[model samples]
Target: MNYDQLMFNINAYKENNQILDLAKFLVYEFELDHPNLEGFGFRDELEKNSILLTANGDIGERQMVLIPRNLFDFEFNLVINMIAHEMLHVRQKSPEMMLEDKNEREWQAYYEMLFHTNFPNVPDVSDYHKKFFAEKALEYYRRMGEGSELQAKYADQKLKVLSLIDNIQHNQA
Candidate 1:
């Protein structure tokens, strides 16, 4: 099948202009300096029926997001969060320096993703995102007990997630 044919709901999945604009804004906002950066889409190879796969972006070779087809089943907030997370990784791997630590890389990505999630003006954030962050915090907390370095790095993110959860709760209350 062709690349477009592999995408779930290809006919209905009209790419949102606002999300694309947000992606561009994020590149500028995060100072990624990627002029050739295109917007998000599902690639033929990345499709896996209904299974949710991690959304990824090309950083070094090209600048564009390649989202998993099944991820479209989730809310736009998660998709946007994943985009932000991947963009943060692109930012982390700048030419001048390399961010080699996995935990650290994830921490930075999660930080930016949470930032977008928490920002009041950002649209499309919903309860689904709140639940996701809560689960993410629990995940980090579990990882923290494994090692001192993990504890140091992941603990901070757990706190960040808690804060985001708190904000979500506070807003609801």
Candidate 2:
């Protein structure tokens, strides 16, 4: 994932009809915006950021999505997932309101991450990080939505998912 190769992929995405296909993928399946993502650039690597959308210009309802090339190593399925995440942000008419509810926002992200990870195909990706990517996060979200204790539910679910994965991964290791 050098700089040149990253640009190559971005260019290839356009030339090979991949960009259009990915844009359609969002529209058809996720009800997300079909982005006109042009090019990526180098930006300060905030430790927590893997990918983010910085708007360059407006094209009707959508803006040109500028990415950070060095932030992530490019993989086809993974890159699609990353773009999909940002598309979620773009689709939000009031992202500031969404951001106000920390639990709901994280719950939605984690809930969606499970789909992107393809738990069956890459189960091990979350084996040691169940709290971040497992059913427990979803369960916590559900309980919190039910008017239960927030922090307690989160704590309980995080450890629960981790423990569940530990049990499942034990002998197979």
Candidate 3:
């Protein structure tokens, strides 16, 4: 996908300010560390979907955060939580790390919503949502074990990328 095009479209929407403000708040509250974050944006089409965030490795290290622009119209905190969750994925190195990080982020987001905030009105998520997330995590782990041709091609690439990230972190220390 064209990162610039997506960014432009998102910025063109006037309601994007609310989402951006929520994102800024999350960055501050979570103390998230990101290097390049110029490519994140909210899209209208993703509304009504459970998928809150998605990252495109081919799109200049950018990510797209989707919120139910309508249902979440009153729940801005949830939108911020979703953005933070996706940011964690962008910071991941290995496929193993990606899966682990995403799971942890989801839990963190849910915990914050349930305990940290004082909404005093939000209901607990349905059992279906809980089951779906668990199943998704299992599917991700299964992919790591599969020996498909695509997996074979990317296994070495993933290792190289992870090693480079580790080396950079070591150098910083």
Candidate 4:
């Protein structure tokens, strides 16, 4: 589907006037440079608990991102965060860069997200959210099976991302 259709779905899922406004704000925030980029919406049953941002190949071709509808049920800020995070991934795809450095790639995306958005100033991330991400990563690993090296790679990347988030929060404090 197109970006507008995807946005409509997200807006429909929003629960309140404040959330609608937040969603609008996020859309405006993303639109500042988003028109030049190529993006499409795809349903991700597997990633129902998480959002993903991926860029394939150089020349900045093949940009794809998915956001979970369930996340919209949590907080409007989260929806904005997920979308913004994925947009950063779209920006990171370089034709010259090798794809093997998964952790490095994720670190770059996380840094981009932090740099682009006004992340909340909370010193410590809630245990609930931490456990949620951990569990989501574990579930992904299980689905990928032990034979898949990608699963292990993702796990390592996830750990690094979590650590980076912690560092950002600590530094902010």
Which pairs of residues clash in candidate 1, taking residues 3 or more apart in a chain or in different chains? Answer: none
lDDT of 2: 0.47
Best by lDDT: 1
Off by over 4 Å in 4: 1-27, 30-32, 47-59, 69-71, 94-100, 113-173
lDDT by residue (tens digit), candidate 3, 35-109: 544444655555454544654453344444444344244333444445554565555422334434333444434
Q: Please report, as a residue range, the 10-residue window in candidate 2 with the lowest summed lDDT.
A: 117-126
Please give the RMSD to the true structure for each candidate, in Å: 8.2, 8.5, 14.8, 9.4
Cα shift from native, residue 28, model 2 (Å): 8.8
Given candidate 2, what's the lDDT at residue 71? 31
State the displacement of the C-alpha of residue 96, model 3, in Å, after optimal TM-score superposition: 15
- Which pairs of residues collide in model 4? 58-95
Clashing pairs in 3: none
**Reference-based lDDT, residue 109, model 1:** 58
Identify the runs in model 2 with alpha carbons over 4 angstroms from their true place.
1-31, 34-43, 47-66, 93-100, 116-132, 135-172
Report how far off residue 118 is in candidate 2 (Å): 13
Q: Which residue segments of model 1 deviate by more than 4 Å?
A: 1-41, 45-64, 68-75, 117-124, 137-147, 153-157, 166-173
**TM-score of structure candidate 1:** 0.52
